[model samples]
Target chain A: MPPVVKIEEIHKIYDSGEVPVHAVRGVTLEIERGDFVALMGASGSGKSTLMNLLGCLDRPTRGRYLLDGIDVSQLDRNALADIRNQKLGFVFQGFNLLARTTALENVELPMLYGARKFTTKQIRERAMHCLDIVGLSQRFDHFPSQLSGGQQQRVAIARALVNEPQVLLADEPTGNLDTRTSAEVMGVFQKLNDEGITIVMVTHELDIAHFCKRNLILRDGVMVRDEAVSNRSFAATELEKLSSAEAAAKLTGAKT
Target chain B: MRFGSIIKVALRALMRNTMRSILTALGIIIGVGAVIAMVSIGNGAKAQVEAQVASLGQNVITVFSGSMSSGGMRGGWGSSPSLTIEDAEAIEREVTGIVGVSPEVRDRNQVLANGLNWNTSVNGESPDYPDIRSWKIASGAMFSDQDVRSVAKVCVIGKTVADQLFANGDPVGQTLRIRNIPFKVLGVLDSKGFNLFGQDQDDAVLVPYTSHMKRLSRRSYISSILIQAASADVIDKVQKDITEVLTQRRKGREPDFTVRNQVELAQTATATTQTMTLLLAAIASVSLLVGGIGIMNIMLVSVTERTREIGIRLAIGAHGSDVLMQFLIEATILSSLGGVIGILLGIGSSQLVSHLNGWPVLVSTASVVIAFVFSAAVGMFFGFYPARKAAQLDPIDALRYE
Candidate 1:
């Protein structure tokens, strides 16, 4: 079968006054199904920009991005939005849960945006199922303010997985988590990957990048290191260091 | 997205700001209330005017003693024999439109009962007087024409008089001693409430003209003559005919009398009431305008406050129409609430006025409906721009709004 993702020389040049800032320049890439890849780059290295183009949130200036083998660059805004709704799921740095909404309601918001939502009683039941996957089934009624940072991020991951999307676009998913909590989050991603959900995440952290099977490093909007991670490891045992002596504080995510 | 979900979200957002919603509805309340109250007051005044006109008797004319010149104290001004019983007879004989003619002799006397006495008017009038005055007897028979020609000593008492003399029993056939002269009771008159002259029409008695002529006789003079034409349409013509005849009888001199009809009086009073009602409504509508401004102001504040919420809703795939519909509904709801409150208050206020001032105020259902509809329209009109502003917001900037 054809590749699950494809890019044909995609370019993104943002107009800042008279100067043209080349946020992404002629980047060509592809990934097969069930691939766990990390787009690694420094600040302004076009990795996040390429992720956005793939997420259908922004368009490439002069190239085609074939997400799941569908050319997104030629599509209009509404069509692009339809693809975003149907195919892709997002997890951002700040965990972007609706402020006043409960965790379950936040997970249910995306399902409500698609057609057949009214007839989709299964959408509500499935939201619970995803929350179960993220280990937040008991906190379905808790609002974002009532949950800790790690719990909030778990809620976001539950939202991304609730649709059972084809690809997960995680923009620094563990950027706000502690070192131990980051490992715990990576363990969840690895487990989801092993269960056949494709993950394409962006990060500058070397330890975070090492958890994925494939890595693409970028500098000045150009890929310089495209290599396979040697061991494709996760530090799930790092969570054991905080599990003892400070179990309550670490589990509750208290500063102490 | 499902419409049910949209509505649920909108309702939740509305519940977030309670005071603003209530304040927005205040305008609609005042507008509707003012309309209902003004209409009720107008109805009251119209009815009052009709009743007052009824008291005077429609199409009736009056001819009085007047304008005696080069004479004594009661001489030059009102000592003329212009309204003699002969002239009353002449009008009865000559005027084509005159349906009935009653000559009157008004006098003030101490009306003596068993022990109580009252200083009430005693009208000396012809037997045709009841028909001429548009009167209906409540209890006994009116004196027949025989009472006028044979000059019987019989009288009809009004309701106020009957209440005083025969407080527990019938006044018919009872004898009342007027100026030490006994007159047998003939009938009791139907009540004619009060009039502009501050006189209760029921507080008087009527006697046969001949009996009064014999007891307090006059040569050819009457206090006033009561005349009813065949209909209101011919009243003015008949009045002109009577005045010309009387003027000629008084030697072609101006007759020095007032000729009035019910239509003119009703028109004058109705017009006055209508103007007063419109003025009241205009005054009340100023409050409605202020309420509208309050709605607009609160909407602006709401738009400012929910920027982040707007962004979240948009990002979750809320369409532009959804945001627009939500804000518009909020504005309409607010205005309708105010309208309801204003209607209740307006009716209450008008009822209070009616009770305090003895005026009739009727709040019509038509006016109430008008007020409610007007408030809703105003809400939509004032709510449009702010709602549009909210709907058109860019999700990127809105999410970043503090």
Candidate 2:
């Protein structure tokens, strides 16, 4: 059986005026179901570009991209959008929740866009369940602006989980959090992965990458290493040691 | 994106920026209001002109000799030196379109009846004059054609002249003087009030024109000849025929005489009034254009301000069409609000003015519809660019917008 993600000789060129810069030069990678993978690279190494392509926000100039064994390389804009909504969920580094919207509405966002034929009560109940998964069941009425950065990131996680996407892609999901909060988020990802959910994340920090079972490193738009993390750092006890609010307070500085 | 959801978001977002929305809508309001007010005024003037022309009697045509002027209107430029009692006799004799012809000999002067003597006009004309001018005898008859032949001293007095000359009792068999030439009143004319020109028709004394010529003035020249055509359809042809006859007689080659058709004159007056009214409206519409520009400016700012929100929505699965609709609805709501305000203002002011002047005003519901449609168009027209800008924003970049 094929892996859940398949890329064949993908080339992404950014055309600036008359010059075409090779943003991603012929990368091919794959990951099977029931795996947690991390793409690690330094800044300007096209890590974000590969993440954008993986998330279906952009298309490669020339390549065959297969997500869940479906040929998605040639999808138009609207089709790509629909695929993103139904097949993949995204949690960005900055949390990217709507500032004026409440936590519940933010979590309810994906279900509203989905074709699940859910009623208002069902949508609200599912959103509440997702928030409960992220352990933010009580902050549903607070706007994103009122929440701390870590809480905001958890709301984004709830939003990503509300529609039960086939894969959850987190791009530096703990980049804006402190050590304690990052450990807590990693614990949540591990717990989710243990429940048989497919997870992919991007990070440049080696310790953060250690939390994942598998690691993929990119350099100069090429994957240099693909390996499982050995003796990975586990934050199983640390997450339980601190409350979310106290853990979230550790991420008070150097956001983004 | 769901179309209904797009509109709902747009409306909610617009509600957030209350002041911007209202200001934008103000532009549409002014445009719509101006349109309604201008059109109503034009329509009112049209009706007024119709009433004034109708009062002049439907089939009336005046034959004077004149060429068309540069200013577009003048009555007595006929090259002819002669439009005699003879031409009136001939039109009465031969013209098929001629309904009635009264040789008008008007001489303005003061007249004395009693202690109530006042300045007034005296018209020397045939009995057909009153009926052609739609005047009815209030108490006594108009002077007969025999009175014209015999140059009798018989006279008809108007209501103003009647009230001024005789305080009470009948003015019949009463004596009045046109510059101290004693004339006995044979009858009193019905009140015709004022015509469109504000000229008082009931402030006159009527005597036979030939009597004015043969006895008092001792001149053969008729000041003007009042001719009534059979109907409006024949006024132009009758005008042409009158021109030919009078020009030949006065100028002997091509008469300089002017023949005025009441129907044609009425139409010209109506046209002039309509053009002026439209010009006023066009001037007012310029302010509406300024208002639309104000809307555009505010909408553009709003789009920039909401860039992050737009990005968030897009990431959540909103298409470009969704973003565009949201902004467009905001603009539309703003303009519609303004339109309602302007409509109320225009209606209120026009009513107040008409009431104060005691002038009849007709405001139609069609004007309201037209104003609203124009206001909506203004919103769409001004909102399009900002909407397009909002729609064209990239979701990734918008998410990162500060």
Candidate 3:
């Protein structure tokens, strides 16, 4: 089977009157199925732009973007949206769950726009299943405001996965979470990846990038490094260590 | 997605800001309410005119003395007593479609009965007067031709006169003195209520033309001639025939009388009422336009406020058409809901006005339906630009919008 995502010489140029900004320039890359990859870059390094292109939210200025053997660079906006709905899932840094909506409703949103007609009952069941996978089954009726930052991110992840998209694109999924919560979120990603769902995450944190099996470094809108993570961190083990360390710190403070 | 689910989504979004939604819809509410109320008032006025015309009798024609111009001073129609009883007789005999003719002479006189005096109109009419005027005696009987020939002082009192003179007691067979002449009340006429000009129709007493000509006005000429046509379809022809016969009798030297039909009078009255209705509806529609503008303004603000949400939806696979449809549905729902509330308010207020002011009001179903559909169309019309603005937003940039 062809790689899930393949980009060849993709360029994104933003025109603002007199000055043209080259947000993404001639980036070529490919990701195989089940590859948990982290895209690491500093601010203004075009990682977000690259993620947008991969998610079919934008068109490249002059390049080819093959999402699962389909060239999406020339697709219209509606067709691009259709591909995003059917073949790709996106998780945003802001945990863009609809405000005032329950966790289950937010999770069921993507299925509402899916190409496959899903009955309301089926949508509910699938949403519940995805929420269960993210360990948020108990928070189904809780709104975004009622959920903690970690739980909100988990709800957003469940929303992304409800349609069963092939590749999950997460843009700084744990950027707003505390260290322990971040590890817990990463553990969900690890579990999803183990179940054969490919994930490409964009993060600036080196420690978070270490959780992925591979890391691609971007600098000044150019790919600088693409290498396997020789020392991959297991998120479940890290979360365990974090909880024990917090427990020990609390005990020592009490003794003092 | 199915259309129902799309509407469901829109309803959910609107419910999130329930207060704002209701406030925004208030404009349409007032607009539609004003429209319905104004239309109902107009309809009521028209119906009142129709009832007045019907009371004037079906297919009845009147011949009034034409305007009298003396020394550049022009007097209105019926100013001169040019119409005579001879003219009425000639029309009755010569006109083929004439059903009945009555020569009328009127005077305002003080009438006394039961030791109480009331000033009212006293009219002299032929025995055929009741038939021509479409009036019926409520009790006793109308005077016959023998009474008219012998100039009997018997009179028929209208409801208003009877009530003024006798109160609850029956006026029939009672003696009433008109202008110091004691006249026996032969009967009481049924109530006719108010005419189109808001004048009381039941404030008169009818006597024989011979009695009025000899005792009351003491005039040989009649004020006007009332003629009933054979049927409604022949009123125009009968009026023309009267004009021809009168013209021939006057030797065609600027005919002295004017022939008029109730149909024409009714048309004129209804036309005036219709013009008033249209003017009121037109003025009320301006508020509906303003309401539409209010919708557009609020929708624009809503689009801006929910830009990020729209981007998120678009990014998640919602087409631009979907976003557009969602906003459109939201606006339509708001205005339609407003329409329903306004219809109820309009009906309530119209009834309230009718009850308080005693003005006739009719809430037509067509007006309600028109106002509702117009409000919904206003929603769709005004909602387009804002929905299009939202639909045209780039998902990537919208996602970054604050």
Top-TM-score candidate index: 3
My TM-score estimates for the predictions, one after another, are 0.72, 0.79, 0.89
Tens digits of per-residue lDDT for model 2 on A1-256?
A: 7788899999889895598778788899888888999899988788888988888877899999999988888897667767777888889888988767789988887776645567778889999999999899999999988998888998998888887877899999999999888987888788888887889999998888998999998998988889999978777765565566665677765353
**For candidate 1, what's the TM-score of chain A, rounded to 2 decimals?**
0.91
- Native RMSD of candidate 1 (Å): 6.6
Residue B339 Cα positional deviation in candidate 1, in Å, after optimal superposition: 4.0
Fraction of true A-B contacts recovered by candidate 2: 0.23
Question: Tens-digit lDDT track for model 1 on B289-333?
Answer: 777777878887888888877765565455666678778877776
Q: Is candidate 2 or candidate 3 better by lDDT?
A: 3
Clash pairs, candidate 1, are B25-B334, B25-B335, B25-B338, B28-B339, B29-B338, B29-B339, B40-B362, B44-B360, B68-B76, B84-B220
Ten residues in a row with the worst lDDT in model 2 chain A? A247-256
- What is the DockQ for all candidates, taken in turn? 0.24, 0.32, 0.65
